[model samples]
Target: MNYFFVINARKFKQYLFIALAIIFSAAIVYSEQSNVSVFMNSEPSAIYSVQTEKKVIALTFDISWGDTRAEPILKILKDNDVKDATFFLSSPWSKSHPDIVSHIKSYGFEIGSHGNKFDNYSDLSDEEIRNEISTAHGILTELIGKEPNLIRLPNGDFDKRVLRIADDLGYSVIQWDTDSQDWLNKGVDTLVNRVVSKAHPGDIVLLHASDSSQQTHEALPDIIQQLRAKGYQFVSVSELIKQTQVETTPVEDQAMKQIH
Candidate 1:
């Protein structure tokens, strides 16, 4: 009887261990399904840095709610003869500024989704996250006649879930390599200095186009001139991604192109 009891106890422990292992594996799979998908080989990765022999970089702007600087900034780019940059436009922002969205495309600028609302993706349910991406994508396509294949999560907030949803929705999630920090209370001189000091070949620099982004606006021409002085040429986010040899198109672009 003693031996039988010991054997039973050992079997019980074994069963418990197996149960725990299953639970752990389930947790991992759940986590992956809940968040953004990961690329094992980094073949379809976003541009976090550039790899060109010459000095070149991409400048990107996030337009969430405000549009005070949108037209003027666009003019600035035109005056500077800047051909390319990426603008991540939120859904509501596009809804309110359809003409501006059109202008962005008409001027040959690349558009990227900034989600449906200006809310943080970190606070959204998985379904909500997918909805946000899809909604913004639809709105942008309807307005500009092209679905954005790139995205910069609102407030730059992202996680595995966010990435997975973006990937599933067919976007290459983009992040900045150089932050101008022009949205902060930094003085114009300091802001320019920070960017200039951090500027490098093949960098993706982040800026903003809201009312509070005046410092960024002020620093733009100077940054351009200085980077030019250093022999750097500006390119769009998509171009920069291509330069690095990473795939930038989301799966959605192909499908939408087919439909159109």
Candidate 2:
């Protein structure tokens, strides 16, 4: 009779359930945090910038639409003695201007893929994105004789799927940390200032080499000078990637060994 009066089975069950729920929620939170830390630390393919103390910056030009400024841009880069500036080329532009393609390589510039055409890849499916990248990859490989390990999506538009497909195809998706806003037809001074102010160590600066950006050529010289003045060394995208070397087997190029 005494023992029967003391026990409340239902109450005990409710307390146990609440305790389990608290533990489970805490476990989920911890798991998510751990995943985030890993992703931040180890994602080698899709990199915006490397975390480094050295003042190294990459200047990139997208040359997808027109070739009018191609030689001019190359001349500007040469005049600045800027080596390893990356040029991402669209399939149509690359195919149509074979001489310019040769010029880019001959001038010792790094060539990258700008997709098959100027396509906004934000909404494309994996297969479609793969097709776009693969076609461009094939073309650029043929043109440059080096399978491009890097790609810059058209219009700077990309989704998670775009990055996944790019990785599967042995390409790192490149996005710039410093955009010149030259595409917006901003004036030369404004464009130069945008890059100079936003640039930092391990930054990838975006400028256009196509006729679409009317003032990039004018702005580039100043941008280069100011960046050098600020003590930032200009590097190609490949050289920039070397800072965070996590060795990856990029899909297409067995001949060209790459460190991620």
Candidate 3:
């Protein structure tokens, strides 16, 4: 009986060692996977390095609902010969403003998904998030005859799961580096100054074009003029991404830079 007990104890000790080794291996793998960084906002400055070598930036707008100033915004962009800009449109907004959508495409601008229902994506489940992104893609593609490859999370809220679903749906998530704060009812001059002071090559700028965004539209000309004076040429978000080197650093360590 003593001999049998000794043998069983030896076997138990071996099994314990094997279990510990497996647990340690799993922990290491989990740590590595969790360390992969993902962008959580829709601002480019959050994820990209601004290139100071050349004068270039992307002007982007988000249209969630209403058409109070869509036409005027379109006209201003057209009049200024601004061919490179991105518009992130909600499905409801697109449905109500078909003419504006047509004009946006006609002007040769990039279209991106703003979400299906204009709800905060952070509050949604993974399946709900996927559906929202996919539905918007389908609508925009039907309207413009080309599928949108980019998406901006509604209200600038996102998580790794949201980004993963977007990637699975064939969209690159975009976050802006510079926000015009036109949505906050700041004066036109104030908005212009904010953009100019933060302007750098390869920066992605955020703006709006709905009725409430008139201040933004009013500030557009000066923002462009001042940035141009500094030798900054505006491009679409897609073009801006193509123009810079993408640095894949951990999202936690990512710091917003003026010009990299």
Q: Which candidate is the best by TM-score?
A: 2
TM-scores for every candidate against the unseen true structure: 0.76, 0.79, 0.77
Which scores better on TM-score, 2 or 3?
A: 2
Global Cα RMSD, each model:
10.3, 7.5, 8.8
Give the per-residue lDDT of model 3 (tens digit) for 4-120: 999999999999999999999999988776663333233222243355577888888888867776677777787887778899898878977888899899889899988798777
Return the lDDT, model 2, position 141. Answer: 90
Evaluate all candidate structures by whole-model CA lDDT and list the values in order. Answer: 0.78, 0.80, 0.77
Compose the digit string of candidate 1's lDDT tens values, residues 1-260.
99999999999999999999999999999898666544444334444676667588888888876778888888888889889888988889889998888899999999998778777776788999999899989988898887789988777776666777788889988877788877884887887788888988778888888777777777788887887788888898888767665423332211111000
Q: In model 2, where do residues sit more than 4 Å from their true spots?
A: 1-34, 37-45, 245-260
lDDT of 2: 0.80
Lowest summed lDDT across 10 adjacent residues in model 1 is found at 251-260
TM-score of 3: 0.77
- For model 3, the stretches where C-alpha displacement exceeds 4 angstroms are 1-52, 247-260
